[model samples]
Target: MSFREKMLWVAFIAMIGGFGFYFLTLLTPIGQNASPDYYLGLLFFIIGLTIGSMLVATLILFIRNRSEVTFKEDERDRNIHKAATQIAYYPLLLGVWGSGALFHNGVSTSIMLNILLAVLVGAESIRLGYQIFLYRQA
Candidate 1:
């Protein structure tokens, strides 16, 4: 696989694993409580875990393929990224608008925050997935 594709795969897995654990934790009985400290800690942990894993994975990949790393982002890669980002934009817009509506309806801050986070994760997942698919096809 190309370096870019490999990086995308790593990002996709990291995001799903990190956020999947986060959301699952939130669904548990204990998570129903709006304890600001606990939520903040968990959020920070997940963010750290996601970013740390991505950085480490990227470093390893770069080490393993130093040559490929230097020549990253060809025309085809750029095109695929552009297409994926454009496609993912729709879900992001929808999610933001929906979150605004929820806010107007006086939803809890925690719920709105989760919704926004979910939207961001979903958009990123879509972008990475589409790029991977395009990479494989090409």
Candidate 2:
């Protein structure tokens, strides 16, 4: 497998783990009360861990296989990414609109932020899934 494919698998696992933690956190009393501090902290933690892990994983991959570490994407990879990103764009736009609606409706900041975070997760899931699909096809 190419490094990109392996990285996609890593990213997929990370995203799934993050989303699971998100929903799990939301089911807690903090989520019930819409505690902005707790929810936002979790969001930050997930983002940090995802980024940190990817970087670490890349470093590890490079260390393990110094010769096979190809960083450049071919045309297919670029097309797959562009298409997947285009697919994810609608959810983001809708999420922004939903966030605005929540604000206009006087919804709690916690809830609005949760929705925004959900949007991020949804977009990421789509992108990762599509990328994996394309990778599998190749």
For all predicted structures, in order, the TM-scores are 0.95, 0.83
lDDT of 2 by residue, 1-138 (tens): 878777888888888886778778788886777756777787788889878887888788778866667568889889989988988889888988888988899997777777787788888888888888888887
What is candidate 1's lDDT per residue for 7-123, written digit by digit as tens? Answer: 999999999999999988888989877586788899999999999999999999989999888885678888999999999999999999999999999998988999999999999
Q: What are the runs in model 2 whose C-alpha is more than 4 Å off?
A: none
Q: Name the top lDDT candidate.
A: 1
Give stretches of model 1 more than 4 Å off. Answer: none
- Model 2 alpha-carbon miss at residue 7, Å: 1.2
The residue-level lDDT of candidate 1 at 125 comes to 93
Clashes of each: 0, 0
Cα lDDT, all candidates? 0.92, 0.82
Which residue pairs overlap in candidate 1's backbone?
A: none
RMSD of each: 1.0, 2.1
Q: What's the residue-level lDDT of 93 in candidate 2?
A: 88
